[model samples]
Target: MILILVDALRRDHVGTYGYHQPTTPFIDELGARGVVFEDALSQAPQTLNSTASLFTSRHFPLLLWGVEHDPIPGVADDRREQWARTPRLAAANLTVAEVLSAAGYQTVALFNNPHQHATSGFSQGFDSARLLDRDAGQAYARVDSLTTAFLDWHSGRDPERAYFAYLHLMEPHNPYRPPAEYQALFPPGSGRHLYANGPPPPGFTGSDLETMTALYDAEIRFLDDGLRRLVGELELRTDLEKTLIIITADHGDELLDHGGLGHGKTVELELLRIPMIMTGGPVGPHAGTRVEALVRNIDLAPTIVEMAGLDEPGDFQGRSLVPLIDGAEPAIEPPEISYAWIAELRSLTSAEWHCMRDLANGRLTLYHRSEDPRGTLDVAGERPEIAELCLAALDRLEAEGEEARRTAEALKTVETDGAITPENAAVLEQLKALGYVEE
Candidate 1:
């Protein structure tokens, strides 16, 4: 199985998702031969928390929401101490990698995102996990570099053994800098600098936003080119028909949608709705199928386990999607629940509505998804009934998360002692260059 995760890649930006731009020709081709989920969402809007859920098949602890330097009431003042106290995937939780490894499959991972590095407890189940080095001199490693590394690794693997390889590409994240050729593809004047140093300046014109979006689209196009090459190589070197290839994003970015410059700040549709395409392997029967049902990232691991014909761990919170893909009704309808947190803001999303509450001030803003997909129009005052329903759902989800946290705490698997070390100077510099951190 091969899993490709692109960082900060919004679904609407791709051609398959109805965008006019030819930003994802290769991905669109993959969609043609695979199942395209119209309403797939990440569990969280941030990488660390969302990926933690993906790897462990459990909801990330709500207590660690803003522990990364952002102050939380009644929490430790020191950021490092907060990280130490933050719950990680316990040894008790069997990761997809560990399960597959035990089942005689080689599990490997190549990621450019620093949040998935070894120190983050994301390397738990992999036989080999390689993160992009800070010395690579770029915030996002080039797609070619990652593809080359993967091809090299696969070259040495045993041909008869089944393998699970994950590739996390960091293109299209931030500081949008596509190659010169791709930059030239856009209109000359449309490439003018916008928010090159910081957030979009006040009084920024619509043209400026357009230019920024053009740059982001170009980044996607660049990555698509690399994917074309990589896919071609895979077909030539291996049996493409039997390989389960899943392409998705860790989370989508907010390109001024809801007036935000980046993600993890809001639970807007653009941030939560990600692209998910599954092709080959057990999904062959579902080729060219588009499932409109809501799917969550947590379902990925269990689906893979089911596809590999292995027994899923009992603690997995997500249901397998194989039945849905194979034209059978799901045994249990998934709950219409999606949760997101950043600092003092928390949002609960359902298929038709989104409700956000500011924990610091107890402010509530509700949006009807069908009427206000961008989440700009607030209807909480006009539609009290919908607002109350959303709030009630949020309350239930929070209670469930609290119960899960208590269980994890009882396992005593959380790292609670100086887990967050001083930032590596090189990694810190790359994050700054990508505009993820302030110098």
Candidate 2:
């Protein structure tokens, strides 16, 4: 099985997802031959937390609030302190990679996201985990190079083996420097205030949004071309049909939809919704069909396990998605999609009402999707009872989340004095450039 995570890919940017551009033609083509999940959501709005939830099959509260890089206040003394220990796995959350590895599948992960650093506990089940690093701040090429190398390594292995490959690409991420050729092919310039190259254009608007989106689309096309080549190569291989393949994103990017340059702090549609599609192997039907039923990243592990015909762990909160893939209306009750912005918790009902509850203080915001799809208009004051219902759900989720955090923390073994050393500084600097941290 191959799970390819396209970093920072927004759901609406692809042709299959109603994007007018032909930027993601390859992925769009794949969707035609596979089950395309239309309403897949990320557990958290950020990469590290979302990845943790996906791998462990747990929600935000069940996993640690922050990974080794994005540390919450007082959680650890320093960055090094966070990295020095073997992290805890959420109770009853077993990585899909672990399950596959134990079932005679060789699992390898080729990741470029710094959040996937070994210290983050995301490397738990893989037989080989490699990180993409760079010189002179250019790293996307490193990801492509490493991915190609990893594929070559696996391809050279025994042909009879069934393996799971996780390719993590950080294109369309920030440092929005798509190659010169590609930059010319799309709308010009990174839209938001420039963090690196220079000052951003003034009076950004929907047109600028389209322009920046064009550049991002260019990057997506870059990835698409590469992935198409990879797929073509695999088609020539002996076990193409036997190998399962899944392509999705860790999370989406918000191009200033809610006054944010890059992702990490928003639950807006542009940030939380991502693409999830499966091709090849044991993935069931609904081929070429879109399933709009709400699903979250936490469900990935359970889904993979169920696809493999293994019993899901009892305590996992995420339900398997096999039924949806099999072209049936989802048999499982849809869970409310929840997200967090620092200490504030937010949730959305499958029916369309979205709610936010501030944990640091008592405040509630509610929006009815039918009326305010962009989340521009707040209807909390207009509907007190509905707001209360959403707030109550958020409160319950947060309470449960707090307990999960405590449990995961309890599993940790303290190791360092919590100081950020030179090595830690290097990593943090990369994260900062990636908009994962502020200087």
Candidate 3:
């Protein structure tokens, strides 16, 4: 099983997703040969928080904030407490890698982002998990080096053992510098900004937006080329009929879609909507199919587990998407809810409307998705019934998440404490340099 997650990849930017640009030819072909979920929503808009939810099949509060922080063994008390408050993947959380490892699979995480360091609990279950540093500035690791590293690792591992490799690439992220050739694909006029330092400057102009979009698409193309290389190599090495390759993203970037230039800020559709495609191997019958039923990134863990024919853990909250992959209808019409704890923002998406709620001030913003996809207009006052329904669902979700968190806290097993280590300081530098955090 090969699961790859591209950081900050917008769903609409892909060619298969109806974007006019050819930003993702490889991804489009992969989707055409796979089962694509038309409305796959992420659990959060940030990497750490969203990926935590992805690996655990849980909601936001349970995965992000509700876990208790403890002191690290080697770190000082006062300094560690503040760093402890940083979001983490708690040991009490059971990861998909851990389950796969226990099932005799060689689980490896050849990742890119600095946010996924060993101290962050992002490496909990993998037999070998480390940050691949074929550095691409703000984009971190180049997908090419990461793919090469995976091939090397696979060649050395026992071939008889079933393996599960999780590769996280940090491309199409920020400081959008694709390879020179790909960068030339969408050469911008000298008048507009191309986001050299980090994100687009505040109050950026419309020309700047177009320029940034071009740069973003070029970065996406760079990643797509890497995907083509990886797939080609994988096909040469493994049997195409027995290789299960899954591709998705943690979250998407904001490019003035809703008056923003970065993510971890809102649960807007542009930020939450991601591509979840399962191709090759067991997806044979359902290949080239598309499922319009709404799904969340949280379902990924369960789906992977089900594909492996393993029993789902009791704490796993998401239902297996295997039925949907097999052309069966979803068991329920669950609302897609995403949380942005940094912004204290949450959104509930249904078939009819999309609702964003600011938890701090209790303000509800409603948007008719079909009418106003960008969500520029707030119809909360005009459509009280829909807003009320969305708010009620969010309330229930929060309650459930809180209760689950409390249970985990009371009956926790592992002891992963936070510390302000030298490594963490370096990681903070990377995240800050990449516009992921404040100074």
Any idea how many clashes model 2 has?
Answer: 1
| Residue 140, candidate 1: alpha-carbon lDDT | 55
Model 3: residues >4 Å from true position, as ranges? 61-85, 134-139, 191-203, 330-342, 404-439
**What RMSD does model 3 have?**
8.3
* Cα misplacement distance, residue 113 of candidate 2 (Å): 0.7
In the range 121-154, model 2's lDDT, one tens digit per residue, is 5666788876655434574444457557766867
RMSD of 1: 9.1
Compare the candidates by lDDT and give the number of the best one. Answer: 3
Each model's backbone clash number: 0, 1, 0
Q: Each model's TM-score?
A: 0.84, 0.82, 0.85
Instruction: Kindly report which residue stretches of model 1 are placed more than 4 angstroms away from their true locations once superposed.
Output: 61-90, 134-137, 188-199, 330-335, 403-439
For residues 1-439, could you state the per-residue lDDT of candidate 1 as single tens digits? 9989888899999889999988999999999999998888887777877777777777753232222332332222443364444444555456888889999998899877766545555667899987765324565568998888899989999899999998988888887878889978754244344553224567777777777788888999999999999889999998898999999897887767666567777666788889999999988778899887778888899999999999998767877888778768643445556676655667877777788888678778988888878788888999999778777766776778666554444333223322322433444344447443344
Whole-model lDDT values for every prediction: 0.75, 0.68, 0.77
The clash number for model 3 is: 0
lDDT of 1 at 77: 46
